[model samples]
Target: MKYQVGQRITGVINKITDLGIFVTLPKNKFGLIHHKDFGANWLHERQNYHSGQAIRVVVIHNYRGKISLSKMRVNDSQLIDQTNDFLETKKENFLSVLAETVSNSQTEIKKLEQELVIYAT
Candidate 1:
């Protein structure tokens, strides 16, 4: 299967070298997760990602059918910033909708109270 950049995939660690870790994806396709891809938290025990270990990675590049994967996103900071922006916008929208609903309910309640007063008189 053709792998595209930014694709998230699950694979087994097939080999480990000083430069990087190699993973075997479905269809026996292989890709390299370079040493630079390891997050700061994992740098200490980099050798621990042994063969047969299952890992989830995102494809960072595909050139001439050779695929490169990243254990951490190549653009993790940008991705996190964008995600935070989207969540903030979503929260604002939810609050606005909730406020509108509450306003409408209050208006309806006032109308009901007026009708009840008219009926009582």
Candidate 2:
């Protein structure tokens, strides 16, 4: 069967190597799930993946009869959540810095105003 990009497919793991895992798709086509496409949990225990193990992966690229699979999408929800949390923290940090800068500017302006008043007296 011809697989297109962004298609979700299930395949059996045929071989596992240090670089990637080869999965046998329908119609004798083989797909590769690169090490980088896997999550930290899977990366740490590479041996857990063995021949004949079934897995669901997303097709990332299909070109010249070669297909690439990505398990990253399986954890996409968690990644998005983490990203949002990080952005929120950064925004809070920026706001704090801005508030401090404004306070310091106000203090300097008050000192200048007192100096001007004394000079006028």
Give the C-alpha lDDT of model 2: 0.77
* Number of the predicted model whose TM-score against the real structure is largest: 1
Determine which window of 10 residues in candidate 2 has minimal summed lDDT. 77-86
Global Cα RMSD, each model: 14.2, 20.1
Per-residue accuracy of model 1 over 1-121 as CA lDDT, tens digit each: 7787666778999988877899999887999988877656446757578899999877778898798988878445533322222345565598787788799999999999999999999
Q: Please, what is the TM-score per model? A: 0.57, 0.56
Candidate 2, 21-61: lDDT as tens digits: 99998788899998877656556767778899998877778
What does candidate 2 score on TM?
0.56
lDDT of 1: 0.78
Model-by-model lDDT, in order?
A: 0.78, 0.77
